[model samples]
Target: MAKRVLVKFSGEALAGEEGYGIDTQILNYIAGEIKSLIDAGIQVGVVVGGGNIVRGVTAAADGIITRTSGDYMGMLATVINGVAIQEALEHIGVETRLQTAIDMQEIGEAFIVRRARRHLEKGRVVVFAGGTGNPYFTTDTAATLRASEIGADMLIKATKVDGVYDKDPKKYPDAIKLDTISYDKALEDHIKVMDDTAIAQAKDNKLPIVVCNMFEKGNLLKIINGDTSLCSVVK
Candidate 1:
């Protein structure tokens, strides 16, 4: 089993059924899942996307907002999410550290690689926010970057679906869920396992990416325990 891993949760998932804003119920559920990883004696780092509140691309679509500004807004959105999850994780008796890529001394510490790794070593869940502190980068890329920097064995992409499929399973009922996929194959086939940038980074770092459903209780643990039937592995 991988001792250390980074898990990425989409901001949209936080909205749950309502489809906007952070849903406390979903937030608490995610926290509980992270706690399961911690209890399993594995070090966990978390990255949550900001799409529920705002998306850089969508905000910039009208052409009034510059891409740079929109991306920054998205980064800030991720920070808000980071704070929420950090709090939820702590409320359940899980030790956590909220660190942001952008300097936010008021609520969290600045992102520091050594400090983050130290927290993981000490068994605290380090929540990474602020999206690489750069514009034009998605939280997916940020997740891969953080996973690589912390020397994590794998990066987990938590989604609504069970695993990566040939096509959108919601649209195509016969879509085949991949059991395992290679980095190059995923890139060439245009699989939506993650964005191209994120996949390339994981490929460079040789970090395995596990795609699994976040809402399903025990799914994270099951995938980490090498239950390939439950999720897809992108390496």
Candidate 2:
């Protein structure tokens, strides 16, 4: 059996057509991929971002509230996404666990690394949310933290683009994509793939990260099946 993996999905990926909220079609497709992985005997965990609902820095920049408070709200938003994803997974007959960094007794249990590992051991897909329960830390940092804690073999960051690029691929038609990159180079180039804190944490923990576009069919499974050329790997 392959090692357990932590997959991180961004909020934008959840936006199927209208560019916001949980898209049922996309959710079902993601759930199917996760189910296929589980069927193949690969342990899976997820860390989901809440940007589709509300963004902390953006809200604060709009003078809606203080940065810290807005970020907390963003964290709450993640719980909502987590719940939605959990439901999607369970609806497809996949066992799952939703662990949150913040304490919301009504929604799910608080994050405990040991408990998460135990769940993974039992073959249940664990969904990690709430962004470390701290302000100013992106969900990317939370994914790295959870992946490190769970001893995941790989940190799979599912994004809109296929892989890391010198510039925003959506905006720059001529942006160059890197198939394999060193963490040091990613930092030097100030790549928008992840925050410095997240990349640093992954590097410090010696965890390999695979960045791929989740929109592609079976892309997640392909990456785990040793298709290194399909995505960008950071070591």
Candidate 3:
């Protein structure tokens, strides 16, 4: 089977120490990581969240802007991030394509499943943005949706932590890391690996979910090479 994978990145991963905006260093690092995957003959797709810019739920919390408008704004934020990643990847000589769920002719091509598949087949990394082009839907759900559409072998949720833990490792000193977890257990125990909807979708599709530390260099390569020590696999 082809080693096609979808990477779901949280918006905060792109942020700086202050956790407020895009960090070029982080972007470059992630680009390099993606480049390594491509060089290793893996087709990659990316879906990034907009929390670093603005979260729709937070925006609508004050009840000033409606949830619908806030969600749309969040979608646009993802586009900004998508284009940024595209530029970063291209700067490092990785062929890339930016496709948005919503039509934005000047910025990116409108998302088409066939086009995305073609891009992947040609060894181009496809950056999926605009969050399913629907209100009240999150980037997590968008990642799963795109992963299923692309027939990806796995969905990787790269985070600061190395793997899934029985509890919040930060708050609980005794938190135990799980090398492998079931989708049902992750959802039942609220593992926080991915959103509930995203996890459920992965379960339905029987797609394996790998959680690894994004900051760790070579972790992606290691995990893909069957290094179980580096990640937690949810299946």
Best by TM-score: 1
C-alpha local distance difference test of each model: 0.94, 0.90, 0.93
Per-residue C-alpha lDDT of model 2 across residues 84-170, encoded as one tens digit per residue = 999999998999999999998788988998999999989899999899999999999999999999999999999877888878877
Query: Cα RMSD to native, each candidate?
Result: 0.8, 1.3, 1.1
How big is the positional error of residue 152 in model 2, measured in Å on the Cα after superposition?
0.6
What candidate 3 gets wrong by more than 4 Å, as runs, is none
Tell me each candidate's TM-score.
Answer: 0.98, 0.96, 0.97
Error of 1 at 16 (Å): 1.1
* Residue runs of model 1 more than 4 Å from their true location after superposition: none
Q: Please report the TM-score between candidate 2 and the true structure.
A: 0.96
Clashes of 3: 0
TM-score of 1: 0.98
Best by lDDT: 1
Top-down TM-score ranking? 1, 3, 2
**lDDT, candidate 1, 19-127, per-residue tens:** 8899999999999999999999999999999999999999999999999999999999999999999999999999999999999899899999999999999999999
